[model samples]
Target: MAIVNATDQTFVTETSTGVTLVDFWAPWCGPCRMIAPVLEEVDQEMGDKVKIVKVNVDENQETASKYGVMSIPTLLVFKDGNVVDKTVGFQPKEALVQLLQQHV
Candidate 1:
């Protein structure tokens, strides 16, 4: 599935269902930019098995703060609305795939 761009208002609903990877990022963050393409590939390869959502820290501060995302590129894996796993910084495609696979 395509990566969904979520906002503070929609963050809960967007991640309320099955396995989801919530990428807390910002446009100005280099690590976030580096992970963008990797996330896209994860979406393409994982397809219906996982849902990828991105929340821009610059615009969605509430969501980021709620999750205690102290830095850019904080990736949280949620299952049925609860976080099951997490990672930070720019992760390679393989690492991301492995992270999702655990929850999938």
Candidate 2:
């Protein structure tokens, strides 16, 4: 499936059961914008190997704060309802692939 969008209210349910990569970002973030296409590429290449989602920090402050997202472009990798790995800042597709490989 294509990358999904999640909110504070639906974060848990969407990320509950499988390997999910949650992008914590705001529209105004430059690096966040740069990583968008990379994430799309990963989603297309990885396919069912992973579920990708983006959470806009501006609108999902509660979830963002809950995850202690101190910066834009923070990534949280969730598996079976827990955060298994995390990375900060804009990352290349290879780095993202590495993260998924380590967890998924």
Candidate 3:
């Protein structure tokens, strides 16, 4: 599936199943900007194997706070409504795929 822009209201429902990578970021964060394209490549390569979503920390603080996302470009991997793993900062596509491979 395509990358989804998840809101606080939709986060729970959207990331409730399978392997999901929720990127907690803001538009002005440099690292977040740097990681956006990498996530795109990962989304395309992984396809239905994973669900990729973006949660703008500036816009969705509740969700970000709930996840304890103190930094931008924080990536949370969720399975069945629980966070299985999390990574922070910018990472290359290969590294992201490897991260997903651990949970998927």
Model 3 spans with C-alpha error above 4 angstroms:
none
List per-prediction Cα lDDT, in the order shown. 0.94, 0.94, 0.93
lDDT of 3: 0.93
Writing each residue's lDDT as its tens digit, candidate 3 over 1-104 gives 79999999999999998999999999999999999999999998996799999999999999999989998889999998899999999999998999999999
Clashing pairs in 3: none
TM-score of predicted model 3?
0.98
Which residue pairs of candidate 2 clash? none
What C-alpha root-mean-square deviation, in Å, does candidate 3 show against the real structure? 0.6
> Model 2, which residues run further than 4 Å from truth?
none
Q: What is the Cα-based lDDT of residue 93 in candidate 2?
A: 98
lDDT of candidate 2 over 1-104, digit per residue (tens) = 89999998899998998899999999999999999999999999886889998999999999999999999899999998899999999899999998898887
